[model samples]
Target: MSAQTIKGLTYPYPEPPGKGEWIEMARGVYWLQMALPMALDHINLYAIEDDDGWWVVDTGMKWGDTQERWKLLIEGPMAGKPLKGVVCTHMHPDHIGQAGWLCREYNAALYMSFGEYFTARALTQEDHAGADWRVIEHFTSAGVPFEQVQQMGRKFRGFGAIVEPMPGSYTRLTDGDSLAIGGRQWRVITGSGHSPEHVCLYSDEDKLILSGDQIIPRITSNVSVMPQEPEGNPLKRWLESLAYFIEQTHPDTLVMPAHNTPFYGIHTRLKALIDHHRGHLAAIEDACREPKSAVELFPVLFAREIGKDQLAIALGESIAHLHYLYAEGRLERQRDEQGVLRYRSVDPDHCPYAPADLTDEDVPMEV
Candidate 1:
């Protein structure tokens, strides 16, 4: 299979900003790229000019260098003005890692969706017995290899390490709520599956949106079945959110995504995301005709080699695809004697044959 592409998706800016520097995206909006120690190497954080100071959206990871970069920005381009507020798109560490520090530095308020704020707070607690146990059991049920599980435990960053000290309280940003920044109103649009209540900001005046991870151009957002909600059908919620965006947003609006360069053609990206998940679900359903564990379906769903460090996320995503089919009545999941869940297609006659071997070229790079 060929890699998926959204035809109209075009990158106007060919280059990204260097460390401690920013590029103007719109009249009052500037974009900054920060380094991350992961396969996904960088995150795009935005700053909008506020009447009092700059209004920042999405804080980068909590690292010493990231902190020093913020300091340099304050003394350089962001000099002489205080940050009006810090608006986080979601609870993910890369998005809200330095929120507390920024709020303290500028005496700015922290704004996030209620779901994201409390979720972050809950994950930060060291003694959350329920959360910790759920993660271990989740992997075991998915049939993750023993050594790979150990590697995952070591690689995954705990919430506290990634997210710095957070404020005791935060102001909530709800769907449809409007925030006045840079003399214009930006409305809040919330999405799920990638994270709980992910926020995307839209400005009617300029037809621009700070579409934080909701409509990325290069890669599909990771929509996994996390430990906190083992049986949750996030794929269903994700498709609904995409439908909402496709139906509501204008095609002319320029979207500034969290991961990739900003681009236009919101409808094109949204449709591609929906189709991608649907294709994955169909593949999983076909592979389940003879009953298969989540681990067994990895090859059918993913073309890449899932390393030890990536096993946890890979398993979670595989389970997510299985859950979507099970939820839709296209497949049924049952536990075996060993207590591992296995799924089989509900209609074997119509089940598509699982491909024998998928080469690197056969799998979409985004998946």
Candidate 2:
């Protein structure tokens, strides 16, 4: 890709809220503010004027405070026009929490990739709120102490607050599908690991991409292996997804992410993220020269001052890295009778392991 492709793409602070004031990115694209209680702080929800009406991308959390904010924006700025539909980039609570309310209130259709929809339903379905006891058993069998497993069970119930119920029906989008919004054709580019079948929209006409959490300008999106997918090596899939995205999208595309500022250099950012994970993998491999439990490796992967919520994300991320390393033969995994997975490094020369060599061609261009 030529460097010129990324030129003229500028990052501007989103327009300030003035009752119903809206900032235009393209001719009809606008961003609405949403509240988040985290160091990351806020999520930017985009609205695109469609032939039918308005289409919204990503909803904020389902808290009453955020719902009230949406009510104000809808009643004021978008009061007259019909909201045609809602499209979620992924299944995270910050991205899909308000979906049910919007669909019910406006009678709008909801769209999401099939995988994400299934995963979202599985997660938010009542009676499925808590952690899987089998997952704790797996960890304990692998050698984690029973006390730590009990602590994890106690903390797992909190996830319910973030993930609200999803709408029963949704329009499924696949790779290569094109949707028109604001008179522009936005092509769906599917990615994985962060969330199953996460779709990032790209418009070649203006070189603009609604990157979702796929390609954030500031921090790398979290790639984790949770209890539900214990054998998953999400780090490997996430890195491959980044590389695939850079190769397919124009280098100069203006990336409007779900969070953080819009910026240039999508390829450069992808490179940085890949390097970041490689470094993390290497660090963990070195640490594993001596046997270490997931808890012991936690501080090495994240800073000590992390908040409880962040620590939870960090824990999953660390486990993902370990899983990837173990899969590649750089680390060895063992399970004790109690069922916890333990890890230690293996000599490269003696170990029967090979990393999967993935190239741009290996990545699917569409869902």
Candidate 3:
């Protein structure tokens, strides 16, 4: 895959490490790519060399030959170094799926932020199935057709399907925590919205950061309103994270993200991500002058019209942007005659939540 240098950010490593192969990004930090069984295929994992062993960050999705690839790396590129610990950036299946198995394999400890660890544990224990009316109603409220929503034969137990059972206990990594491995200091820089308390690691001496999903050099991360939290404004939290990262991160640091290849230009990329959402907020706010449901606002929100395939994610993210404005009183919400949630922009806004200046460029609106 070719990495695009958007908004002045440059890809230092154009060719990603293929399959079980690995590339050294720094003195002891190595980059490895693993396959995923989806359109946006592939996740990047890291192995930081320690004196006695190694520390892994962001285990790949528990699908395809991901486990086999892990075995290959452990036996091959890793030279059979035992894992010192497994550090997950967040609770996402792709990032934390193999955490349990890895920890068990090496008798290593698990480390994550409080929110990520607990949320993932909760998902593994969540019990809901067989046409839960609440779920159908939630989709309907977002203006999805009853027939289309009914097409879901059964709700898939997604987390349990992909993720190994979560570890009962974990060493919590807070925002300012520092992890010392291989004589290099990596500071934990946490951000929210993509996932609660997403942990990123920054090393000023090495001039690189394990940005995770918080700062992808290529495509933007999805910040959506999940069905569980219908009124949640993750986009607000997502927008707030830009400035947080800008202040915490150095502009020269190379970003080792979970998805795309390693890249540089943190401040520009952060502002660009901020503006991308700001553009989304602006487009929908303009269209919301006429009351529209989250689903109905897709035309102005996305570069291409969404279909049933894209409905679930598109609707969730659309609602997130709307909720951000609505919560700030820039927009007001009311249900339509069909009982679908509709939003309308309020007159001249005085919101305290002022973000960075939005670019005039038309940012692609795909979650």
Candidate 4:
């Protein structure tokens, strides 16, 4: 797509930051916000002063303009201290794209959850550069039509542009891991579905949580199922993660999400997100009373106007919800003569595809 078209979608094109403009949250902690081209709008990367030097929470996308902004921040606002380390919230391009570059420039170590690190490496591996074709073929094998497969190919080409390379190695982190940064102990909290091995950092001393995309104040995070990794019930895992997060974190904690302004009331926000997904699932199930493809369900799920990037996310989310319902036996699916899978809800009272009880093992966490 053309740059003009992409900009029209309200993607933030970052401009260099001026001097003395950084927002300091706590002792030796600051926030640098950058614009994103996706529906998420913008992302906030936190700068924390470590014992050695400095640590960054997440980096923005790998766009030229974003790189310039980072250059300004490093040379201007954070000029005195050397960057110590980097931490990625997840494998998403916007969060992890600049990690490798930062690590190389500062000679810093990168730390991420084991799952996130491996998943990011796999996606960015040289061998997988043109693997979108393989993904298209996989869906085709699953009975997706040739035309839809071509459309998917177009979507895959944009993936590399959004993400930058990752570091060669990373220190693997897990749930309950503690790290001292900015003079505070931050506990690692894990969540999935939004992205595999998504980590949220919570500091009890300051009641602040670096939520990444797990718990946004505005707009729900996209939970999708891609061909490379099918059988991913992102919606279910997302809900479970939200419940767990709410249970673990205090309601009054300040949530510094990657997108949108930092806010409080984690439990209330979690409830709203859960309700949003439940409503979408019900709407998809209702629409599936008559066989419908994921493409057809996209407009219904996202009635709001969307650009190509948003459309891609909407389609994936629709398919994800459809797959979840199908797995739940609430819907019956079959491939048509054209090799496209069609889905229709099964009547619980009379249809053979009656709903069945699902257990924790029945639904697995995926990104």
What is the overall TM-score of model 3 with all chains considered together? 0.92
Candidate 3 backbone collisions, by pair: none
TM-score of the candidate numbered 2? 0.85
**Candidate 4 lDDT over residue span 1-367, tens digit each:** 1112112122222242333356766677777787776534567888888766888899888864777778788888788888887889998888888888889987888999999898888776534323455567545644446676566455554345566777888998899999988689999999998888799899987888999989865456778876667667887788889999988897778777787666666787787667666666676676778888877775556645545445455555777888888888888998777666788888634433222222211111111
Compare candidates 2 and 3 on TM-score and give the better one: 3
* Sliding window of 10 residues with minimal summed lDDT for model 2: 358-367
Candidate scoring better on lDDT of 1 and 4: 1
Q: Each candidate: RMSD to true structure?
A: 3.1, 6.2, 3.2, 7.6
lDDT of 2 by residue, 209-281 (tens): 8888898755567787776777788888898898899777988887888876667778777776676667567
**Candidate 2 backbone clash number:** 18
TM-score of each: 0.91, 0.85, 0.92, 0.83
Given candidate 2, what's the lDDT at residue 192?
89
Off by over 4 Å in 4: 1-20, 38-41, 126-134, 137-145, 151-154, 157-162, 305-308, 348-367
| Model 1, global lDDT | 0.79
Ranking by lDDT: 3, 1, 2, 4
lDDT on C-alpha atoms for all candidate structures: 0.79, 0.73, 0.80, 0.72
Better of 2 and 4 by TM-score: 2
